[model samples]
Target: MLKLDHIVKDFGNHHGLRDVSVEFPANQTTVIVGPSGSGKTTLLRTIDFLEIPDSGRYQFDDLDYDLSKPLTKQEVLAARRKLGIVFQSYNLFPHLNVLANITEGPVQVLGKNKQEAEAEAHDLLKKVGLDDKADVYPDQLSGGQQQRIAIARMVAMAPEYMLFDEPTSALDPELEVEVLKVILELAKMKNSIVIVTHNMDFARGVADKIVFVEDGQIAYQGDPTTFFNEPNDRIKAFLAAGQFNVK
Candidate 1:
């Protein structure tokens, strides 16, 4: 299980997270939703240690961290190996072909032989429906295709937990669905996944638990059905203003 307690991140003038605490259960998909600049992304980043918090206690399986203190390089790396994150941008190496990009981590970090890595990369490419594009460069692929490749690359590492921060926010509606489909498949495949997104429909359909954030704090956290069907006044207003077609 992944857990956080009294997490706080101050950006000098404002707080990115205000004593926020939440638990993400193993093998469950947790979807985080909030308005723009509500610190939802900040919260997600903190989990991966990309944006270390000012103060808090974080527990990832048996590893524990004191957010107020700096973590050793080895500690950070050990924790990161168990988690994988995909961002809004595909962030693929433009210079490398898709297969090479996917194999790089496994070969360099995990010490897998090139032959083994390439074979696994080919299998992952097939899994993401990009088996034919392995020889192509990132620039040659469409935005949706590159994002799918990004997912494939992450899957190649076989992280115990997958983290997605607005993974499809930059793509068109149709393309966004393409990435969401892969995410749904990962969730069903029993990976512990945490996603920060604004897509209400996807969240409603995929989330086992919904966490609502506003003003750098959790406004609500519970079942998706209750979050949508029996929304409180604040959530009701947010849904109406955001124009989410929840029904």
Candidate 2:
């Protein structure tokens, strides 16, 4: 499980996060949905230590960390290892083939033997349904395929929690289905899979719980069923704007 207590981040004049506190339960997936720039990405980044919060307490498994100050190199590395993230862009290395890209981190950062990393990379490729593209470069694959490989690359590290920031936002509608399927498959692994998405349909299908964020704070969060049925005006208005059908 991962918990953020009173998380806050500031950008000189504006606040990126405002006392954001949320918990991602173990073996479950939580979906975060909100308007653009509503602190969704910032929250994910902080959890990954990509953007350290100004102040907060983070609890992961048996560890608890105070985030009010800069973390040491070891601390940052340790935090990053547990929380794996995928960005809107696939962010694949054009110079490497699919298999090579997937194995790079394990062999380099995790210090796994090259042969062992390759074996695991192949398994991950199969998990993402891209086993056939092992030798292909990022430039040779479609956007969806590259994203799947990206997911595989992250998975190779065996993170305890996974974070996705608008994974489908950059894909065309048709391409999104494949990527979403891979994510849903990951959800079945019973890990903490937190996704920030604007695709309401996809969100409804995969989320065990829904978090509605607004203006740098979480406005509402609960089970998916009640979240859709809620009569709160602000939430209702937001859903209406997105044309999301309330379940």
Instruction: Estimate every model's Cα lDDT from 0 to 1.
Output: 0.92, 0.88
Q: Number of clashes in model 2? A: 0
Best by TM-score: 1
- Per-candidate TM vs. native? 0.97, 0.95
lDDT at position 187, candidate 1: 93
lDDT of 1 by residue, 1-247 (tens): 9999999999998989998999998899999999999999999998898988889999999999897898889988888999999999999999999999999999999999999999999998888889999899999999999999999999889898899999999999999988899999999987899999989889988999999999999999889999999898889888878787544
- Kindly report which residue pairs in candidate 2 clash with one another: none
Q: Against the correct fold, how does model 1 do in TM-score?
A: 0.97
In model 1, residue pairs whose N, Cα or C atoms come closer than 3 Å (at least 3 residues apart or on different chains), thus clashing, are: none
